[model samples]
Target: MTGFVVRRIGFYTFVAVVLAFFALPLLWLVTAPFTDTPTYEVKVPDFTPANFQAIVEHPYALGSLVNSIILAVGTAALVVLFASLAAYALSRVRLPGRDALLYALLLLSSIITGTAAMVPLFQLAVTVGLIDSQLGLILILTGGLLPAAIFMLKDFMDSTPKSYEESARVFGASPLQIVGHIVVPLVRPGLATIAVWALANVWGNFLMPYLLLSDVEKQPAAVIMYTLYTEGGQPNLRLLSTFGLLYSIPVVLMYLFVSKKYGFRFHGGIKR
Candidate 1:
């Protein structure tokens, strides 16, 4: 009885500490936005929405926000669709070199990093005349993000029993029909988790967009946020806080909506 009680107490203490670590910075940011501007100083006992207003009304800032939304949604949808198809094939099909292909994919995924590939990626996009475009960034981000998304969905599909697909096939179902009618339905939770993760990645990416896109109007929120910090002079703490919070709202809302609607099972391995 004493051991069980100690375990419970330790668990609660860990939870509390973790929560505080994550929440404190956000709390400080929220309050900072309300501070007075020009100096962009955080004033005590004074917090207002004026700084947020300035950001929303600014053309560059507002355009960046819109560009972020478009790219995030586009990348998420693309990753989920392509990854789902690839993962389904990997999980369900039997081919001569399927295992070898899967190993190669995993190997390639481990070695590729956006920062390392940035120069070639920029030159390639420039050659294709994709530089300085939202679509260019979207395509580049999607290529890097899809492999991991496929791996995530593949694990989820592996957890499901083969009987599900076998039964569908026995009923005279076509491949497309089986995927559409059986595989996708069983993997809904995993797909939701993948979409949420993909959107978050695209929204937060800075280096690729910063390299390929120079047009202020085509830049995503993360890029603009960096410019606001590094180039716009000494940190305007108030404006910085305000825009940061606003910038985060879309991702936070997505996480909230996804978590509320769907319980995610992200653990590895298939339970027999």
Candidate 2:
């Protein structure tokens, strides 16, 4: 009994410390937006609108917010469409070397590096006239995030009973019907999880947008935040902290929605 009690106490203490560690920076970030010091100092318990107002009232700030939203939504839709198709094909089909194919896909997922193909991808985008466009960023982000989304969706689809498709086929339903009417509805929650993950990645990523888009107005919030770091000839803490807080809301709201809707209890596995 004593050992069990001591273990439980230690676990709770560890959790509490971790929670504080993560929450502290966000807390400081949130409060920083509402108050500002005369220069580069941290203002404690001061309530003023200068920082938040700067982000809210600036034209470039609003444009960055719009670009971020468009990029996130576009990438999310593309991820779901392509990932669902790929997952369905991988899950429902039986073919030669299926195991090998899946293993290859899993390997591909492990090799993703945002910077590995940067130069070539940038050259291709420039060749295709996508340089400095919001669509270009969305396309790159979607392609970058697709592998993991497909892997997860495939596992979720495998968990669904095959009988669902068999039953639909008994009534003369086509493969498209089985997928659209039956499988999709069942795995909506899993797709939501994938969407949340994809959106977070695209929204928070700074490198691809920075390398691809040269127009400041078309850049996402992450790039804008980076600009706040470099464009002023030195680090500006007030603008950085303010934009950081502003940039976080959409992703944070998305996470909260997914947690509320899904409850974090996803059960699915791709079996051999």
Candidate 3:
């Protein structure tokens, strides 16, 4: 009995330690922004708005947030639209070597990561007069994300009831109409999942935006956040913590809204 009680105590202690390990960073993030002089340590904040005032006065801080919104929304919209169509077609069609092709594309995308393909991507963008353009960045991000998005959405498409499509066809509904009305409604949860995924991916992305956009005004929050440092290479914890909280809000809000709406379940064709 003593040994069992000791084991139970040990387990609870370990769980508490693990929880504290993850919780401390979040605690710092919440408390530091309001501190008069924030630091690495999580101390009681002085509850000052000076940090936010400083960010508001900064030239590019708020504008960079707007740029991030534009990039994340545009890329997510394109990814959802294209991924849905491609996944639907792939699911419905019986083409030779289609599965092999999908797997090949997925493998290639994974192996040839963004870092490896940036040179070719940059040259292509330059050649096409897309350099320093937000649209170009969106297109590049969309292409890179499509393979995985399609692979995931394809499962949803497969799980969808084909009888609904056949019924629509019997009523003389065209393929596009059927897809727009029938398939889309059933797979909306999957679509929301893809949109959130893509948005988060593009929101936190820095490398592509940093390399593609040379103009300071055009850079997103991810890029602007990097400049929150002193000339001596020390991080300005005040502005950094404040901006970090503000930067995290939009995505968190989006996730909450989506989660409340659809519960983030992979229901596919099963109507909720």
Query: What TM-score would each prediction reach against the true structure?
Result: 0.84, 0.86, 0.97
Report the C-alpha lDDT of model 3 over 41-86, residue by residue, as the tens digit.
9999899999999999999999999999999999999999999999
Instruction: Give per-residue CA lDDT, model 2, range 85-121, as digits (tens).
Output: 9999988788899768777776776675778878888
**Winner by TM-score between candidate 3 and candidate 1:** 3
lDDT (CA) for every model shown?
A: 0.81, 0.81, 0.94
* CA deviation > 4 Å runs, candidate 1: 1-22, 37-45, 230-233, 266-272
The number of the candidate with the highest lDDT is: 3
Mind giving the per-residue lDDT tens digits that candidate 1 earns over 1-272? 99999999999999999998888776777677776553433336266678878887777888888889999999989999999999988887788987777777767877878988888888889899998888777888889988778877888888777786789889899998977887777778888988988988888888888888888888988888876665647676655777788898898898788877774555423334
Q: After superposition, how far is residue 175 of candidate 1 from its true place, in Å?
A: 1.5
- For candidate 3, give the lDDT of residue 43: 96
For all the candidates, what are their Cα RMSDs to the real structure?
4.3, 3.8, 1.2
In candidate 3, what residue range of length 10 has the lowest lDDT sum?
263-272
Query: Residue 109 lDDT in model 2?
Result: 60
Question: What is the Cα-based TM-score of model 1?
Answer: 0.84
Q: Which rank order by lDDT, best down to worst?
A: 3, 2, 1
